[model samples]
Target chain A: MTASKDKEEISTYKTQPAEILAIRDLTDDTRYFKLRCKDITMNKDFQYRPGQFVIFSLPGVGEATFSLSSTPTRRDFIEFGIRKVGSFTEALFKLKKGDTIDIRGPYGDGFEMEDLRGRDLIIVSGGLGAVPLRSVLLYIEDRREEYNKVFFLNGARSPKDMLYKRDFIAMNQRQIIDTHLAVDEDDTGEWPYNVGFVTQLIPKLGELIDSENTTAIICGPPIMYKFVIQELLKLNIPKDQILMTLERRMKCGQGHCGHCAVGGRYTCLEGPVFTYYDVQHIKELI
Target chain B: MSKEKFPEFVELIKSKGKLFGPVKQKEKYSFEEIKDFSELDFDYQRTIISPKKFITPAKYSTLRFVKFGQTEVLPDDEPQIVMGVHPCDIHAIKILDRLFLGNIKDPYYAKRRENLIIIGHSCLPDDKCVCQSTGTDMVEDGFDLFLTELDDFYLLWVGSDKGLGIAIEAENLLEENVSEEEIQEYVRWQQERSSMFTTSIPSYKYLADIIHLNYDSDVWEQFGEKCLSCGTCSLVCPTCNCFHVDDKIMMNAEEGIRERMLDSCTLPYYSMVAGNHDFRPDRTARLKLYYTHKLKEYIGRWGQPSCVGCGRCIAYCPVDINVITVSNALFEEVCETQEVCDQ
Candidate 1:
């Protein structure tokens, strides 16, 4: 396997293999895997920022990009929260814990703490959307004093669908954090919290906005942005102040594929994350 | 630069590498491998397909995964001599050079480029050609040798050391005469070529700005209804370089080959995300994106429009959707008003 540090080797469609250290079912369709590089130094040197993505592949199956759910500060292993949506993910889901899989990337512009520092944060996410934000949340957890008040609003279909529940509980226990949960039309089982759209919780986050110092980081289903953005705008939040990550059909992860283009920008190159001010000009985005 | 002895140069280069030149297939001409020098026909109009496929193939095996999931890159190392390429097509290759060989070099494209030799010739403009207005009717570089017509003979312009080496080696076949009449003939051919353009743009400058102002223009929706979504325009373009990759696993599950193939934006599912969110869901949006990338976005970064104006997209389009016509419609309207104001 070539070193991930080589830009040419890493950027090519060619992939290096990684071993799955552990696998756990988060939901019926979604699975979480702990992957480590086959080479010990690669595992130690393999670093990625929050919101940066990797093009995970199932050799002879296909390739798809997913956000690095693990924080960059942790060097033991990298994690991905994947849902079996298509044939590629289907192949990945079938792999056992000991099985090895092909891997490439740590592509795209990621969320930076310097950009979000000195501001109170409100992270709005739903379902698997929380995966990338978990990186930022953990980074903030490491340096707690850089930010002011922090709020995390997560939504799921049911109690069974929630990911990293222990971390949510741990975050709620922290004196500096306020966590809220919501479920949309859950009928399969009991879900404790607000029982409507995730946008409904936006009004409940009072005094979290300081105008100049408050920044909102959002990631969710494409449709959730419709209502959530409206609520953020209702709070008189400048479009630039509201930051969100976008999901697109990313193939190259380096922008050459042109599969994930939104308007003039390649989501894999220019973003997977953008301020509302940046994406408002794109007519395709809601 | 005697026209009769040009076939000798072709024969000489054939010994160096695989020789390719334009050959008449039915009514159109295409770059095809040939052993005999007489097979080349420079009189035919345009090829149904651009020669872009020689570098970036339609489908290729990029890599193979072995037992431990390690990969081996499979690149085509064969050298080629591409002869009889048009100046417009030469411009298109330069555009591709900027994209693939720039900031992050695409290994697949770079390897092919290294093993290739380009010999270009000036072509007469057809009715659909907008190369004159697009400023791609002529090119200064990106070719080893460029031949321009001059009455009964041709003027050979060597662009690089490789071209000079070929010229030096083939000096016996080349005429070394200094005649004023022959030089005037070449200048006259240049002037004649300038008057052959049938389609002209009112303004090539500020074209990106024009597109920016008309982002919501209804003109795109009008063409959207007529577009069959066949994707022939992108397929025939010399500069369209978008591609997709897939890994094929055998039943053994331990090994598979990674394949790359050219992808078209006109396809319905080209931009579909995991949650079924497609940014360019409608035909209008897709066509707009196709035009925008060629005219606006490429210029913004690369300092020139990606479209060489070879008009292959216009020639091959099933629905008669011409990018030049659409751009002219946008520019002629605004430029008319501006000219009147200046008067």
Candidate 2:
């Protein structure tokens, strides 16, 4: 019987205490939060890949999902780019720098960094989608030599709404990887990047991208997928090579909660990141 | 065991733990606390809710939060015996066990499950019972004790060590040996029960494929239009385990408890993420998720559909829409009324 196995069993629902280390505003609505496990052992041992997420439980409020906005290469502390959208995030936005919250899991199948080691990469993001893709870009930056030519295309509503604007500007200044930033309408006349959708930037990669060798990673609003995917397909990128991270209502980061189910697959289990080929047949997937 | 000795055996089992069995309440049947053996109405086809409620209550506290941190709140370790469970309901419990006890075990569910002792009883099929098609009509195991009632006595089959201990303790009231004639009679009873099934989901094996083929079918819109979204189907379903969690603060405001409650996909916000993006915004989409998850997706993952064909949806759905009507509509392209398609 499983009764004897109970002693060694760690409940999936069990959460660890995490204290806010730092907080900074990326935009009026979105903020960058850095948190570390209060328990030294847990903080030291915790490791997660890019594109995975954690469930932030705010006792007396509710629990919400947040993608890991930091890279695994960086040890101890984890970060999230949270937008004040709902009551949970509203409460989350109120907490100060030293406040503690319950956090569990480094769940979901994140980006496969090792697999894309030798491949050319095209990282794309728009709006809050940059939160998870930021982890991927930073990971590649840390291990720049392992991968081939890398191109980043980011878009936001405007200059003021852009998440991690300073970081992208700094990366662009570094000039090690090709970085292209765009905004729908730049309210700040001083904004240096292109003034259109991110999809428009894909054409500039015309001769630079080796279609067969390149793995395109995209994360953005639902509307961005159609036009962006069209551009990527025009470049002849294989369906399986085009990976996009998705968002769904998730309570438990584990597959126990059925909210994140897309067709037969649980987005929290099989993916929050899925290959275009994987979900092409699933009608409900957006 | 003889019919007269059954009451004495029940008394012995009641001493073991809190014994619960099927009891009649007004016009409906439910699994309630059995104060006496007479309260057990095993003649009924099904209960309003399966034994799942005992395992995962509609609502329970998972974590209790204080000033600094939170503590896990597990169900009390009181041993409970739920008797008179039908085979299909037992199968449903087994499915719940596999989900809640398999990889990434739910601690709360695990605790409640460990404290439960299942005692199944044989039941005859009614017009609504479709377990024959779902293949959950008979259960060989997953129960501590199973009683198959005969003409004048009961053939008690012990399935576990706990049941064996009970048999040993009640040996004074139990018949140790049975005749070859009685064995033949039991076989005859099994055949008669098998022939009694009048309901089945035809071409059950192809339901998954058909559901996929009809993903864009208008039949969903028709059903969704009638759906009340009351979530009664999921509540009555033995296998529906989706839940929503909330945090409730006490009046003092210093302490609170995180509560887990049963949630249905048909509900308004089952698939709504923060920022209010509802993946399944309309009734049609949500209704599709409910049926597809149970009928098609479960088969892909577990090699069997989650619907045990206990027929709770058929009996309880206020609207005339159910697995039978929906499946028939998809399979035969027929509706309950001719005007349904014409309109």
List each candidate's DockQ score. Answer: 0.54, 0.63
lDDT, residue B127, candidate 2: 98
Model 1, residue A126: C-alpha shift (Å): 1.8
- Model 2 residue runs over 4 Å out of place are A1-10, B334-343
Candidate 2 residue-wise lDDT at B62: 91
lDDT of 1: 0.80
TM-score of each prediction: 0.93, 0.96
Per-residue accuracy of model 2 over B1-343 as CA lDDT, tens digit each: 9999999989999998899999989979999999898898888998999999999899999999987777889999998999999999999998888877777688889898988888889999999999999999999989999999999889998988888888899999988899898899999999999999999998577788778777888999999999999999999999999999999999999999999999999999899877888888999999999999999999888888998999999999999778899888887653332223332
Docking class of 2: medium
Instruction: State which candidate has the highest lDDT.
Output: 2
- Give one digit per residue, the lDDT tens place, for model 2 in A19-100: 9999999999999999999999888777788988888898889898899999989888999999998899999999999999
